[model samples]
Target: MWERQDFVLLLDLDAFAPKDRVDAFHLALNDTSVPNDVVHESPEKGIRARFETWRVGSLDLFDVRSTGFEVRRTARHVRRHRERPVVSVSLQTMGVHRAENAGERYVLGPDDIAIFHELTPRLYGWSGEAASWAVTIDMEDLGVPVDTVTRASVRLRTSPVHDLVLAHLRTLRRDPGGLEKDPGAAALGTATTDLVRALLTSAAHDAEDRRVRAVMNDSLTQRIMAYTRCHLTDPELSPDRIAHAHAISRRRLYAVLGRAGIRLEQWVISERLEAACRLLTSPRHAGLPVSAVAARCGFTSPSHFTRRFRAAYGVTPREWRRHRIQESSRTPPDGPPDTIPPTA
Candidate 1:
């Protein structure tokens, strides 16, 4: 029914007669940004199909619950529709399913995740009350190498990060409100995208050369940055601890960070100092002591925080706060004109 609309769709084939199921399902699949041909072996009793889908930024979430059937995305369909290159991730929640693309077949059982290219010729088949939560991400916005993505689609074995991605996706599917709005939604989308990229890159590491490993290293760097950003307040946020948390050696972690021009120790200190600076400058935090801000930002010693803060910003924390407050007071009611800070 919503063939032309590009937003959200909730389709239930059970509401339609058997003769109309094909058309209804076709439109629903198209509405969810996947156009395919659905085939059934025989006319049977109670052919049920339901899809609940919504868009979260550039990503689309689809929850499908249906009976036994096969869906095909053929070369002809690809030519006629001219779909964009997208990465499709399926989190199988119930039963088993098979996906074939680029002459490779992958079987995904319960609690499994499979990756595929949306524009490629593919086939999907499942029996019984098969169901899954699927998400399609735009390839261009993925910020990872396209070749690795193509290789990863062939087959991806599950890992800790892969399982985390599945659990997070289940949360997203259950309550999408956290990803449908602004501000927080952007972070949510970015987190999900990074997790997916990390999962794919890690899975693609087998039989890879140095070039491909470099791409995978970039993904690892991103995941490490995300992990560090969230744990900056921890007193034990050292290279050893971070490396252990990610199951990578200290040497490998250093190599990965070096490739990105990031020194692990310096980066962590920089992040902590940045957080402390924000707190010092925030009006709401004006009453907070410098030592409190330092401790809150992971510095064990106030003296060390003061020395490092002065070295990085050319002023002590208290001096910087005083100067910022003076500058704010001198500005007119309209507020200081927008100025871009110089990048270090």
Candidate 2:
């Protein structure tokens, strides 16, 4: 009854398990953990557990990393621990347990799940020493609609669809095979994302009224912005340039960002100024003229930059630069608009 054929482990199974498949999935269940004993049993009856911590490039559209724990019933108690940048969703496939965390208690059973934001500083425990499976996903990794996080946490429900979704995700986790690059990976990634989103929405019914489409659009825009910033050193970088990079017309790009307030041009300049502010305080650029730092963000004229950066932050470029050099962290987050470089 090897539930996980990934690691080699002792599996005591009756005739029911697929002979060759059980042995393979059985071996896959061997796991290393923090003194937690995981076992492999019949594909359906015994405890079969697998887990691993995952980290990937965060700059991608799917900025997600995961830590997963899949286990059959066992007697050992799991100590509560906090995971930053993640929300822990515990699903009780076939066992029952009480989950304790952050002064809140929850009981989970078959066809049930619990949602606990591990991002909160807290502790947690599994009740009844019940064996279960849980997945720790950096909410960002799951490309969760940040705008809807408050709504989704209202409650947790179980969805059979998760069985299919989780299985596909696990397959992707192990397969390097996929689209050639971006467009390809992005397409499959999007599909994988839809299934997960559907399951999440189903569990947290509040999403029924949520703006799932708008959130996806906003997130896609963010992906475009991140891409633009990364390629800023390129002399051709501009609103049109970025739109082209994302395979959209310049007008369409602006339309996409109509919801965020301010035009695309303003957003890019704001981002550049923010980046420049941090560099303005750095030692490498401290001795250089303030104009040089402005140039780095695509400014050509010192006079124009000073007025904008100052307008944004209330201090002239040189004044802001000096303030930053002395105590950068104290520099107000809003760089004086007076110091912002003029529009290109």
Candidate 3:
């Protein structure tokens, strides 16, 4: 629901009263996904910080031009985390900036793109007034592993594909309203996602045959797993059915799964079990019967579901649900939940 809503936020320190500028800037940055502390270095020049953000489709397009300031994410901050995972692609358009992550440092200049994982402890700063345009990629929408995305980030480099992505971003920024109003906005958005995925994939590739095959297989596995997840309730979700849907031979599909050290049937069963567990633990489905839960997760019979559930989890379905309820009651309201629902 939030994704469908279109909004924009623009903040300029110069527009605010001298007394309110610092507070306003701090509040504004706090509202963003990449929250950070802002410090004014030169008291005489004041701080020249301006930020504009547009939420278009799955991407958060950010245009930031700030005076010399430092943004730091400390280990303490990581412990009290509030933000979800996001990959920031910084396109340096003006002055240079330095980024430090895991003891590695990178200096980026104009036309150079650097990627950073927001959840990773890092520090970035620039001297004088540095200008840059950043595109924030939602971790969930990247269709790849967070580790893979992180590996492709925070590097100082230039490429033809990077130039193309920058061009598309410039067009999107110039006429955001027009693009949003167009009928092909969704398609264009998808194109941008694919472009970003391609950029990352290309950057992380190697010349070795084994490495290339591994990369291709990993991407294929992610796509197949995503498809299976969406169609988990389908009773006919067999390896043959998946192969047909993806236009790949069944043998090839088996080989792909084999490379990932998983069997097709095992993957499907695990996804179904995860879905059933999720429904059983959810308050919304509290009144749903065990048979209903089993049927919803593609099980043909309640007894079969119970047997498999107990075998995999070392507990019966009812016992598992009771345990989850008790645990939830004792845990803090804002505490993190267990990593269930199984992502591939």
Candidate 4:
């Protein structure tokens, strides 16, 4: 099973005695990753390894830096440790790595990426000091057939989607701590899954397959949602501009989002209202006037913004900000303030 950890688990072999470091590192792997046999290449020289992992929504993001070692997952291991199938994509950031799966073998260098499945027997290892960033996703969540994933695994470099997905993973690794605390972390995980599905669809030879086409359509919808979120502050973020930016017809965009139950205008307005609410209550934006806040949140007119904000939140923006200020004044630094009784 994929371990769900909200905090990072770091294991540095230097903290253990030379004789016990290898064993400790081995045990750490079993706890954080799949069950497998770990063998250090030169235990006599002492093992230098560091493993860190944390969860991002349903995805497991990990980083490993170690001296020469080999990890073997045999048929026996798979049978004994029966768990949900997962696919792992790893990007080699340093040194060389080798992977073998189902009789196909590949050697990867810096910036190269490889994909492997947990349900299959495999061998993965590297010599000297090597580092990599990887993410594991459940097969059910990936929404792609096992055959499709396997077919695309070896040919990922052939498609531009490969670099796009790689860049996303790099960004996740760049600031994992910040990402873990982000409210949109779950959305980011979903976006990663969608990008992987797109990469698989593009790399696989069976692009004409029915299921592949469905995955592609779903990926487009996700892309639209992500793009909209990023451009929420732009006043020109309309259906025509969004559709044109994605190179899809306005009708096609509507069809995709409509099937997903998203009304473009309503969703956009709600998002803007929420943005305005956040800015109005923030101390950093306290000096700004309500009209300025509305304008900054993509509202062309302060009157329209007030109407929508009041309709959605049951109070005017100024009242909401004043209430927040009052609440802060009543709150003590050491403890939470007593709950205010509801007014009749």
Candidate 5:
């Protein structure tokens, strides 16, 4: 059913008979889609929706699931889409989604986000109620240059920013009221949309192939970044070890780090410094010595890390730790976590 006021198409297919189900809602979108394709047979029960809103940034949303058909939306695998002229940033809010873009396939699930040029041949399919949430945004409006958008969209590893956007989208879904009203809704919408491009450029991590190298490198960098966070105290951590474990070359490691806006050694040092700051700030780790904490986070020389830490954070590691402890003692829970609603 299409909601005129909201410009939203809501599809609920749980009630359709198995064969009837496939026949009814398997219709592909035609307005700006690549074509001459149809669903041969539908899978079992699933839900899907696609909608658009022409507000700031031309917000568009697509939600769908239909037994994971390779249903077409393009003329061919290589042909560019002349119709859907916008680049889309998609967030997997629930269940799962599999998309083929840039000649490589991505398996994404709830909370994971990806960006792709929609004008190119792209395919999205799902099964088992594989749900997703998305917002289609135009390229030119993204503030960053097309080259920057192109660079960032495929190179950067997913960041805290992506999680923040996912949180906002899911929160709005659970509470659509705040945005349906006046300036408040508009304000929130603007803020939410602004982050979309940031996430794209950041995820693109400055890669153009946008296929295996871009995403794989980004994912590797994230895992490496995370591992560094968890083991900041271990000085043994280095690019060689990371590359060996991930089965990539040292050049590839540095390239991945480059996408994160820092090279390998610099990145490791910086991440350790950040973790040290976090540890110092938390009351739990506040009692630990600055040097010990530094060592634990892979920082060798206390003075060197301290100088860099102060430069990066505008305060010494110890000072940041103290400030954090003080802040946490008074900081209340900001709000409920934006969580996925089971079996909507």
Candidate 6:
């Protein structure tokens, strides 16, 4: 039987008759998403399983606890779910979980996280009493290319962000009710997306196959831009630090960005200048001095900041602020004000 409470859904085999448990479980899973073949290790002893699911924004979270069972998704199943692809990140909480996908076998113990794609054929099972929590994210929402995901799937632990992401997932597992009731669940979902992107980007960079790495360089360029934007206020942010952070050589980093036509230092300078412009026009920072705004946006010197700001926006910071203020007074109360365009 399936139970629904608000946004959460639960299916407990105990609620079903002994003869109907397996079929009910299969049907429930098939109804939710893709189809899979489920086989209990000891049907005579009866199946004891519970599945609970809830949504955190665009990500769907699942908690599955069972005695022992095997679930297999064949090529036929992949074909059925081809149009709607998803990546699942599963964290084993109790007992051992084993998976075979893409001609590779993976074993995960308690606290281990495994990432797999639903578009691929897979075999997953547990031998004894096992419990796991997983989150399903649409590949489109995940923002990583499928090839990069497939390559990073096997090298997740290599990323420096892996442990941080693992901790975050653990926290999500700890508070289902709080997540459901929280108004900021959407923001948390966005943060999860960013963390997962960072993890996969870093992991994919560690791949040994140079051909695959080269193929993923374009995705890596985007990750680098995102990482740089987040660390714009850090004075220590540099190509060496960025390269080390992503576990790639500095030369490789330059080459990747070069192929993408992104001048690293110039891009960083433009981003900082853009940030300064936003602060200059912001009402909250209305009282902040031009030099203070520059410092806050990662410019080391006031004169250097002024030169770059004028070069990028054709106006000094003070002039930009004065112009915005004047424009704001003339605009209708409900109308949108013009924004400074980003530097190229």
Clashes of each: 0, 36, 1, 0, 20, 0
Task: Order the candidate numbers by TM-score, best to worst.
Answer: 4, 1, 6, 3, 5, 2
Q: Which stretches of candidate 6 lie over 4 Å from their true place?
A: 1-7, 207-344
Q: What does candidate 3's lDDT look like per residue over 171-268, in tens digits?
A: 45544544555565665566566666655665555434454344444456545655566677887778888888657999998988798687878778
Candidate of highest lDDT: 4
Please name the candidate that would achieve the greatest TM-score relative to the true structure. Answer: 4
What's the ranking of the predictions by lDDT, best on top?
Answer: 4, 6, 1, 3, 5, 2
Give each model a TM-score: 0.60, 0.38, 0.54, 0.66, 0.46, 0.59
| Preferred candidate (TM-score higher): 1 or 3 | 1
lDDT-best of 2 and 6: 6
Instruction: Report the C-alpha lDDT of model 2 over 1-344, residue by residue, as the tens digit.
Output: 00111222223223234455444333433222122232322334332222333222221111111122233322232333223344445444444554444345555665554454533322233422234344445566665554333334434335324455544443343322122122445445444444555556555453334554444343555546445656554545788777876578988888777864547667666766765675565554568677787788776677776777887889886777676445544446653222222111
Give per-residue lDDT, candidate 1, residue 20.
86
Report the Cα RMSD per candidate.
11.1, 18.4, 15.3, 8.1, 12.4, 12.1
Q: What is the lDDT of residue 198 in candidate 6?
A: 70
lDDT of 5 by residue, 1-344 (tens): 00112334444455555555544554434443434254433343343333333332245556544344554556463264554356666666656667665556677766566666644555666655444555666555545445555455444354434555555555445423223533445545555555565465556553353543543444455455544444456788777887776678888877777876767677667767645654565444547898888787777888988888988879887677566555555655662221112111
Report how far residue 76 has shifted in candidate 1, in Å: 1.6
Residue-wise lDDT of candidate 6 within 67-111, one digit each (tens)? 898889998988898576888988998888888866788898765
lDDT of 1 by residue, 58-156 (tens): 777787888877889887776664345678787787889887876887787876777776656788878777888888888877765666776766655
Model 5 — TM-score against the truth? 0.46
Q: Pairing residues by index, what is the TM-score of model 4?
A: 0.66
